[model samples]
Target: MIDLRSDTVTRPSAEMRRVMFEAPVGDDVWGDDPSVTHLEHYLAERTGKAAALFLPSGTQSNLVALLSHCQRGDEYLVDQQAHTYRLEGGGAAVLGGIQPQPLDGLNTGELPLAKLKAAIKPVDPHFARTRLLTLENTFHGQVLDADHVAQTTALAREQGLATHLDGARIGNAAAASGSSLEALCAPFDTVSICCSKGLGAPMGSVLVGPEAFIATATRWRKVVGGGLRQVGSMAAACEYALDHHLPQLIQDHEKAERLAAGLAAIDGITVTAQATNMVFVAFEDSAFAPEPLHAWLAEQGILVGALYAPRFVTHRDVSMADIDQVVAAFRDYFQRLTR
Candidate 1:
């Protein structure tokens, strides 16, 4: 099946697998794993953070950051639709006793600084203490404006609120924006970056922040079962992706543009948004039922979300030829529907 479901589904390349096979391993719980140590150091330096920790997944990475940043009853403000707040199974609330104040955000996933300022609870005992303001880059494949982020982080700092960034797709953001990785991560106090996403690693996420904060996150990681032994295999794959596949993300973004352009010409479909390896298409008419189109595409081995404005993701495994085939399948489906 042509899995446009998510970038997370991409398998590791042979070169990455070779590196994993030859990887040097050690006990990470004792802080001696060479591969994990190398990955953490590389991510920290690249993001300009004082330190970094390798976690099993993005969910754990974000959870550790949340646990480190906020205490029990302390609230972290986040976009209502962001992965950290809406997804991640409410780990912060359930496991850490940290509350998330989910707030309205723009389609680009930017929370208004004014709204954020207003949301910060006054020291009154009646409200949960607002401890952190979290933001997501490449929110639904839409990159947040750098100026907006700079201003928001500055405001948060002035208000004595710590800032965290859930940058599960920061490489995509960097690729699309022509910004350095460090430049993208410079504003926030903590960032959770996923290698398993568009980077094409089989699994791994690196959380970067201050040394003291990472120490705190390290403790949280252990409590949450992220302290794995001889995790070098996955760590090696992530490092391989960072070294080789990071630059190819532009091709993924370009293919998304191509897919969007092709889908826009279809009668019943509207390409609502396109950026950084993902396309969000909407049904032009409410009468245009999605089930038939989905079924037809599925028969052709083309996969997409089962919704009106379904999202299509492009990744390392999807080529230009695959993009054309997907477009053709979409065109054929619409053509048959019109018949």
Candidate 2:
């Protein structure tokens, strides 16, 4: 099937598999994994953080960061649409005993400062103590600029709150915004970046922060059962992706724009603003619901994502040819509907 579901669906390339097979690994929990340590150091240097810890997944990385930053009964603020709150299965609340204060995320992927300020809890006994402000960059494929991130982090600092960034797709954000990864991560105290998503790694995420914070997060990672043995193979894949795949994301963005323009031309389709590699397409009429559209596409040997509204993503494996086939399918389906 020609999968346009998500960048996460892309399999590891041959180079990545080769590196993984040849990777030197040791017991990570014992702090003897040279390859894992190298991956952590590389990620820390890339983000300009003092230290880094490798985690099993982006969700675990974010959860461990939240657990490390906020105490039990503390509150953390994030956008209502953030993946941490919506997609991470309430790990913060369930495991960390923290409350999530959901705020509106601007179209640019930054939370409104005034709204964020109002969301903070006063030092009274009546409310849950607001301890941290979390932000997500490249939220749903839109890159939030550094100026906005700096402003929001400054706001959090003034309120005596720490900051964490859920930067799962931060590489895409940095590439799209023409910003250095270090510059993008400068404001937040900690950042969790994914390697398995658009970065094209098979598994793993790196959590970057001060040495002290990462030290504590490392302990929390173990408590959450995220400690892995011989994970250097996975780390090797991430290192390879960081070195090789990151540079190709811009091409994916270009392809997404090309696909979006073609979909926008269809008579019964509406493509939302395009940014990075995600495209949100809404059918003009409810007569063609996403379920039927998804099934029809499957019959045509295509795989599209089933989201709240129909969603399609461009990734490493999806080429211009794949985009053309998808567009042709859209045209054929619409023509048949009009008959």
Candidate 3:
């Protein structure tokens, strides 16, 4: 199937798979895996952070950051639609005892400085101590720029709050925004970047931050049962992806834009402005259910997502040929709906 569900669906490329198969393995939990250690150090250098910890998933990385940064009954502010707030199953609250204070949507991809300042507790005994401000770049591929990141982080700093970034698709955002990884990551105290999505690594993510912060996060990672043994294979795949796949992310973003434009041209369909590799297409007519359209596309060997709003994502696996097929499928579906 031509999967457009999410970049997380991508399989590792041939080169990545070869590296994984031939990787030198050792115990990572014991800090004896040379390749894993190398991957962590590589990510730290790339992000301009003092240290980094390789984690099983972005969720674990974010959760570990939250646990390390906040004590029980502490709160962190996040955008309402952020992945950590909406998608991470409330692990911050349930496991870390950290409460999430979601800010209302800010269209410009930044929280208003005044609103953020007001969200911070004013040394009150009755309130949950707000200790962290979590920011998400590309809230599902929207690509918030460095200026927005700088302004939001500046506000958080003024309120004495440390910042964490859920940078799952950070490479895509960096490619789209023309921002250096270091410059984009420098504002936040900690940032979790995924290797599996878009980058085509089979599995793994890295949490980067100051050496002191990462030391604490490592403790929390073990406490949360995230320690891995013989994970150098996965780390090797990430290294391969970084070297070979990261440079091609812009092509995926371009394909997403092309898909968005094609879908927008179809009657009764609305496509959001394309930024990275994700595109959200909505059927304007309430009666025009997405199920049949989705079914039709699947029958034509296109594996689209089943989201409530019907989201589509272009990934490393999808190509210009796949984009043409998707556009053709949309044309046929729209014509059928009209008839």
> 2 or 3: which has the higher lDDT?
2
**Residue-wise lDDT of candidate 3 within 1-339, one digit each (tens)?**
899988999997777778898999999999999899999999899999999999999999999999999999999998887889889999999998899999986754578778888788877889999999998877778887677778888888877899999989888888888888898899999999999999999889999999999999999999999999999999999988887888899999999989998989988889855668988877788777677777898899999778467788899999899999989988997897669
Q: TM-score of every model?
A: 0.98, 0.98, 0.97
- Per-residue accuracy of model 2 over 248-335 as CA lDDT, tens digit each: 8998899899999999999999997788998987777866567677788899889977745667888898889989999999899889
- lDDT score for residue 207 of model 3: 97
Quote model 2's TM-score: 0.98
Question: Which stretches of candidate 2 lie above 4 Å from their native place?
Answer: none
Off by over 4 Å in 3: none
Per-residue lDDT of 159 in model 1? 91
Instruction: Give the alpha-carbon lDDT of every model.
Output: 0.91, 0.90, 0.88
TM-score (C-alpha, index-matched) for candidate 3? 0.97
Clashing pairs for predicted structure model 3, backbone only: 138-143
Cα lDDT tens digits, model 1, 1-339, are 787888888888888889999999999999889999999999899899999999999999999999999999999999999999888999999998999998998868888878889999999999999999999988999898999999999999999999999999999998999999899999999999999888988889999999999999999999999999999888999989988888989999998999999999988888888888889988887787888778888898887776665999999888888999999998887887779
**Worst lDDT 10-window in candidate 3:** 104-113
Which lDDT value does model 1 have at 94?
97
